[model samples]
Target: MTTPAVLLLIPASSYRTHDFLEAAHALDLEVQVGTDQSQVLAEVVPDRTLVLDFFEAEIALAAIAELHSRHPLSVVLGVDDESVELAAQANQRLRIPHNSPTSVSLTRDKFWMRQCLAKAGLASPGFQRFSVASDPETLRDSIRYPCVLKPTFLAASQGVIRADAPGEFNTAFRSLQELLADPELQKRGGERAKWVLVEDYLPGLEVSLEGVLTDGCLQTLALFDKPDPLTGPTFAETLYVAPSRLPETVQQCVRKAVEQTAQALGLTTGPVHAEARVHQGKVWMLECAARTIGGLCSRMLAFSGGMSLEALILRHALGRDIQTAQTISNACGALMLPVPKDGTLHTIAGWDTVREISGVEAAVQSLPNGTAVRTLPHDARYLGFVLVREKTPAAVETTLREAWTQLQVEID
Candidate 1:
């Protein structure tokens, strides 16, 4: 029997590449990585890494085609948001099982995503798109108070802001304009950089759904509860605890909403990560992406006997049988260590203390000393992540919070 070879599309900066490679090693599968950085090519998978620009899909697909001609790939997977569309396009070209490129593209654009959900009779907030060139004051009359302003293509709350009134909206609009002016962000968003999405704010508990879609059916892996209310002028995710404490009925509603949203968006395969708000027994779909949870958050999940989420995703991509998809009985959670302020990070204290906390699993720092870091609306990367496993969800949340309070970040 020939071993299945898989091609993975990964951003050079993404933290997920290592986890995916670890899973592939365990599965004994031959792996090749496609990235944009030539220097990283030798660092990751050595001779197996192919240099491909994620932003230029046409050129990326052409390079992938040439690579595939030499080594046929049984699976082509995107490791993060930046690579999803490219992976879909490559899959379509190779006739591999994957979500349609059109579907993936729709998910990337917030404006189109809301339009499709609303058209399909799903629960979606009323939203409008504005151009960066439009005068912020002129657009005021069209927007309702207490709404969110977001860049159409940026994710992880990089350009997400909330406005309680027209004045705040004007400020947020201008801030978004400045954010869009960022050369790196502009390069990532392409033409979508010109548009901003404003949506009526949905009030309630915010939760995230992690699942996989196969043959148009959603197999829910886990539902995470955001214990800290996401009510925001600026949204910064802090804690996520799973084996959600919500009532079973509410959980069912969230599941149905996600399933419907995925169907509406025409996502039929691979992992799906979705966010929604539950308000007074009603579910409002916020957004759904054709990829797994972002950052180190996936560390919170583990199958029956400690199988990582990455392993499960790889197993599904290779058409292997999954005996069970249930996470371990013990509750697990992760905290995205918040950046105290925008400045150069001088040092981080309490790593040793936090690691020694009961139930603490790992404490990781993503940035190094003297590295400049900014808070949300301009920066999306977290300082680091803290993982914990406890007997109950509440305990897990408490442990994560307690550990977080002990740490101190010095940004000069």
Candidate 2:
């Protein structure tokens, strides 16, 4: 039997791509990565690699065409929002199985996502977009207090801000508009200067669901608990505990919501990352990412529930029998290293002290001691994360707090 050749849509350095390779190996599939750098592509090539210039749409299309000429490509997958669209376009061009371009667009644009979810009768916050030309005071009057504002395309809470009143809204909106109007940012978005989302704040606990979508069929892999209440003014996530402790009924509701979303959006394949807020005994779907969770949070799914969410995504994208093969074991949790304030990295103390804490298995600090850290005006400050493990949830939480308190991460 010939091994299936999988074409990945990202550079190899990305954590997502690395996890994909691991999952592909487990499924017995040979993988080939597609990237823009010819040099990097050369290093990974002839072992079934292809060079794709994702930055330039025309170039990506041409490159995929050439690869199609060489041999049949079965599965195409990518991680970032841009890469997701490229993957969809490549699949469509080749008449292969993948997500529809429309679905990819809907997932990429936050404004459109909210519209779609609301139209479908799914619970989503009321949101509107703003441009630099819009009068800040007038806009503020129309918006609810404690609303969210950020760019439409960007993620990771970059430039996201919260305004709790008319005065705060004016100040925040003016500043955000300035950022959007920056020459550098304008160039990145092809001179499209639009302020981000203005969302009616949802009061509740936020959680993210990691799952796989096969032929528009959504499979719930793991439900993650956001250790911090993400009631947005600054909606940056902190920690995640896997195998959510929510009641069975709520879990079922979340699963059904995600599945319905995938179907409504026509996401036929690949991984789906959905965020929702539980408010007053009801679940409201936030925007969904057509990829895996970001940053160190991916590790949460791994250690918390013994489920490798990213790996499962890779296997599904590589056209393997994921349903019959994947497995999970123990509960795990992860916390992201947060940026407290804009300052030079000074020193992190008590590293040795935390090592002495019980149930503290590993601590990975991504921020270096001299690196610059900055925080949003409304967001809570976070230094780094400490991972703890135990047999029971109570034990896990106890150990986590102990390690967190013991670690002295001082920034000056």
Candidate 3:
């Protein structure tokens, strides 16, 4: 039997590469990493890595075709937001099973996403898109109070700000304009940087839905209750506890809303991470992505037989039969260790103490000592994640909060 081979379109900064590679190993699949970073090719075994410009779709497709000629690819997958559209395009060109590039594009642009949902009669917030070049004062009268300003493309809450009045809205608009002008954001966002999305803020408790859409049907894997309120001048998500405490009826509503939203967007296959708010018995779809949960948050999920979330995704991609996708019966959660302030990270104290707390699974830091970091509305990266597992959702949430209070981050 010929060994199955897969191509992974990953960015240099992706946190999921190691997990994906490990899953590939478990499945006995030959893995080739396609990246824009030439240095990354050297870090991997020479034959296993393909250097390609992810920003240029045509060039990237040509590179993938060339790689496929040498070793046939059974699946093409994207590890992060930056690569999703590229992967979708590659899959279409290769005649592989995947969602359409157009569908993925709708999800990437915040304005378009809202438009689609609203047209479908789904519960979507009032939204408008404005070019950064436009005069803020001209748009001021149309602005609604208690709204959010967001970069059309950037995720992880970067350049997302809440404005309560005209003064705050103007400040936030200009702040986003400056943020989008940065070379890094411009390179990542391209034309998306030229526009910003303003949407009415939905007041409610937030929850996340992790699921997969196969044959245009949504099968929910987990519903995470964000115990920490996401009310934001800047939304920095903290603890997320799985097996949400919401009543069964509300869970059903969330599931139905996500299913309808995916259908509306024309997303058919692969993993999806969606966020929504529930207030007064109404579910307002915030945003949905045609990718797995970001960062190391997937570590909080596992299947009935101990299959990792990455493994299930790989299995589905490979067309292998997955008997079940149920999350482990034990309650689990994670804390995105908050960045206290903007500055150079001098040190993190009490990691050992935090880890020693009962039910605290692991506390892993992403940034190195002395590296510069910033809080939300200006930055998106979390300092680290603390994962926990307990018998009940409340216990897991409590453990995460207790562990968080024990640690102190000092910045210079």
Compare the candidates by lDDT and give the number of the best one: 1
Q: Score residue 144 of candidate 1 by CA lDDT.
A: 88
TM-scores, all candidates, are 0.98, 0.86, 0.98
Off by over 4 Å in 2: 11-13, 26-28, 36-53, 182-193, 302-307, 324-327, 349-361, 377-386, 410-412
lDDT of every predicted structure (CA atoms):
0.90, 0.70, 0.89
lDDT, residue 295, candidate 2 = 59
lDDT of 3 by residue, 98-170 (tens): 9999999999999999999999999988999999987787887889889999999988888889999888888
Looking at candidate 3, the ten consecutive residues that score lowest on lDDT are 38-47
Q: What is the lDDT of residue 280 in candidate 1?
A: 63
On TM-score, the stronger of 2 and 3 is 3
Q: Which ten residues in a row have the lowest lDDT in candidate 2?
A: 298-307
Kindly list the per-residue Cα lDDT of model 1 for residues 253-366, writing each as its tens digit: 999999999999999888999999998678999889999998888887888667799999999988876647788758989999877799999999899999999999889987
